[model samples]
Target chain A: MTGAGNSALLSIRHLRKEYRPGQPVLKDISLDIDARGLTAIIGPSGTGKSTLIRCINRLVDPTAGEMLFEGRDLAKLAGAELRAARRRIGMVFQEYNLVERLSVIENVLTGRLGYVPAWRAFLRKFPAADVARAFDLIDAVGLDESFATRRADKLSGGQRQRVGIARALMQAPALILADEPTSSLDPKTSVEIMELMAKMGAERGVPIIVNIHNVELARRYASRIIGMTGGEVVYDGPPEGLADAHLKHIYGGEEFL
Target chain B: MNAAAREWTRFTPGERIARAMLYIVTAIAVVWSIRTIDIIPEFLYDAPEQTADLFRRMWPFDWAFYPKAVHSALIETFHIATLGTILAIVLALPLSFLAARNFTSNPILNLIAQFIFVSSRSVNSLIWALLFVAIFGPGALSGVLSIAFRSIGFVGKLFGEALEEAQQGPIEALTAAGAPRSMLLVKGYWPQVEPAFWSVALLRWDINIRESAVLGLVGAGGIGVALDAALNNLYWDQVGLILAVIFCVVVVTEIVTSTIRSRII
Candidate 1:
């Protein structure tokens, strides 16, 4: 995950996604993200920030666009190639979407599922190195090592999100896409999660793209900012360049800011 | 709604007469059937005394007969329940898969699977035992087969609903990550369904115990055979002993199943 290419780790050109046949949700959005840094996409709900990041991993298919990752076009690939691409890209979710009944360690190991064969994972027979890596990540994420044996259902919202981040890191991904990862947490936990993501991204030199709703929080943690509105990019530059007028344009109201 | 429509609440003269006529017709039909069948209301009042006298004659559950009743007959009851449940599980798991709308939403397959389930469950267990006994010999095999057939329908319908309703969040995540179909079942589906599987299987175990106890009455090998023989020979004491043993078995099964259920949830 370190220093694959210091140049823009992920590049996009003319990305478009339409859930319905004629009505487009994301209209020809394009942006580039550098490695080893935090880039935040901020906007109101349903403005397609989530859709734009999901489109990078092909969780939602882009209707039309070219997404280039390390000189490879993501839109043109299919089947195994797409899966291989996903293995290199990790995702953190808003709901802290750990498998509730699975042990915390089991949930983290799911990040390694792309690399491990089906039968091996089924039998819970992961390699010693992978198992040790999962333990290391759990510890690094500030979770008690004993928590690995407990089911994910028993954890509080903040603790569960920590496990979610640990799972994403277990993949050793070159890029991380977080879809409102801190929205479900309390204010303090949200800031802590933001700090954790920034720290993890810096340590591993992985390009991290997060969709956030809190503009101030984004400014605090992100080196770069990409604001979206009405399925298109409204602003893209350094965090300092994201002014009050730009926020008004992206959210359609200046009073809140 | 409208003022005029709201004002018109009462029935007219002709409508009232028509309703009275329908009631009179229904009364006449009921009276005729009662007469045809020679209805007797006295049975409800008179039978209680006679039933009490009969019970008094068979007092104390014939405690002396309990020892003989505890041996091979009890063993046979366990066998009937075990074999029946195994057979039911074999047929039920696959049928449950087909019946799950999520797995097999095809109209033809869904209809056929449900039809098989409904047809198997339409008759009572005793009726099934009777039919199987008439077809096969009067033995434990017939009783076991009958109980299994009834259980297949019950477990299949319940477990199918459980499978269909699995938390779709995990499955969607797995598919988004390009997991194969089998991996989706193991990772996304099985975790949600495990508790449900336990509850259903444990419930079926208790039901099979009750069924197996009575299955012997059709000449299937269990304690019910002893009860049937005692009743035929007018040995009320022996019949009382068999009933007592059956009660003990029911209570033990209740305790066991409840314990298992508590652990699962």
Candidate 2:
């Protein structure tokens, strides 16, 4: 059913995921993502925050539900259709996940793998335009041209995360999913990373969905916040509306607060 | 303060008895093995004298024979090793992917690939040479085939292990980016395993050189053919010369391959 004024880029209805047969990680989750704002999914460890983000990208397949993006159900897509859909959704991992032996530029170039021919990607012969765009994106991510030729393993954690961000943006994706994008970084670097993500999301008009454990950082950067506990959403509202009572309910203890 | 702090070093009676029994059992096994193998003290005492007489005959090695016979046989040995290593690596590359757990999750394919590796590895190179010699009627072709077949298992097993141990993070990232299977292999997996692949190939080549040198004893071709002839004709000096050549070749191959491996890896 085509809609007149629906701005939702992604619509999830009754999404569920279970790694084990009887125990579910995500239980009947539903949400709608607009086209241009940062949404943070905040929760304690062992919750389904990461699972919900991964389900959108199909990195972790759903047990049951509908994930509608670009007018197609992501959960039902398979093979070539799944791949074609995946290319439009960029994912940033907790570990940054840059190929360690590859140079920074090569890692970023991998983002264009879906668009480039397989043989060309194998030989690492990216088109001139893609190379130019990669350099531009690297610069946008606050990394210089010299860092582009350096191998990924040689870079520090923060620098590698910057490369991760550049690589994700190079896909020119419609949506970006970051699973604990700043969890491994120090507090200062975490703030910088969150700011960079927020600015990039605004500039590119792409919705950013991040699964984070840091509540303060989430409140500081997230335009909209989704609080979850025990594999179900406990609260969903703007960051300003997240009260201490909601935090106590979501985290299940007052001492940490 | 607490009952004079019981001593930790003292062993219980049962532990002490078990330790004594372990030593007694080891000693008995060693003596039994010596008797079973018939390692006579008399033969051991006579070995030095016999070795001295053999060395006296082998002195003044046939330096004049190096140009015509020894040189060509040595060249043939090198050729056989090179060809065999190349063939083995070409065959092992695809088989390694099939054997890797991450690549081939299908249990039947993994078992089949693992079986090929086990079968090839279980047969010694000399036995492979003997079988090939019978089939091909004694030539360098037999030596080459034998080396290749024997090496396939070793290369495949090591390379497959390297693939399995590669970091999963990059593979997941590539998959999420919608990269196909080939792209995931080349861009995601190949870079991580490149050093291991090179190291294994060089190590296998070094081993093949030594194996090929001895293949000619079975009439499969190489310097071993010269050695076999010298032994049959009772040419002690020529036998010494052939051995010296083999020694030099092996030492040089070891040095060269190690240098390359260190530089690359």
For candidate 1, lDDT tens digit of each residue in A171-217? 88899889899999999999999999999989988879999988888
List model 2 lDDT by residue over B38-118, tens digit each: 878898999999899888888989998788689999999999999999999999999999999998899889999899999
Scored against the true structure, residue A42 in model 1 reaches a CA lDDT of: 92
Question: Ten consecutive residues with minimal summed lDDT in candidate 2 chain A?
Answer: A1-10
Give the distance in Å from residue B50's predicted Cα in candidate 1 to where it truly belongs: 2.2
Highest DockQ scorer:
2
Q: What TM-score does the first chain of candidate 2 have?
A: 0.97
Interface root-mean-square deviation, each candidate: 1.8, 0.6
Deviation of model 2 at B73, angstroms: 1.6
Please tell me how candidate 1 rates in CAPRI terms: acceptable
> What is model 2's native contact fraction?
0.75
CA lDDT of A101 in candidate 1? Answer: 95
lDDT of 1 by residue, B107-181 (tens): 788888888889878977788889899999788888788888988888888888899998766665555555666
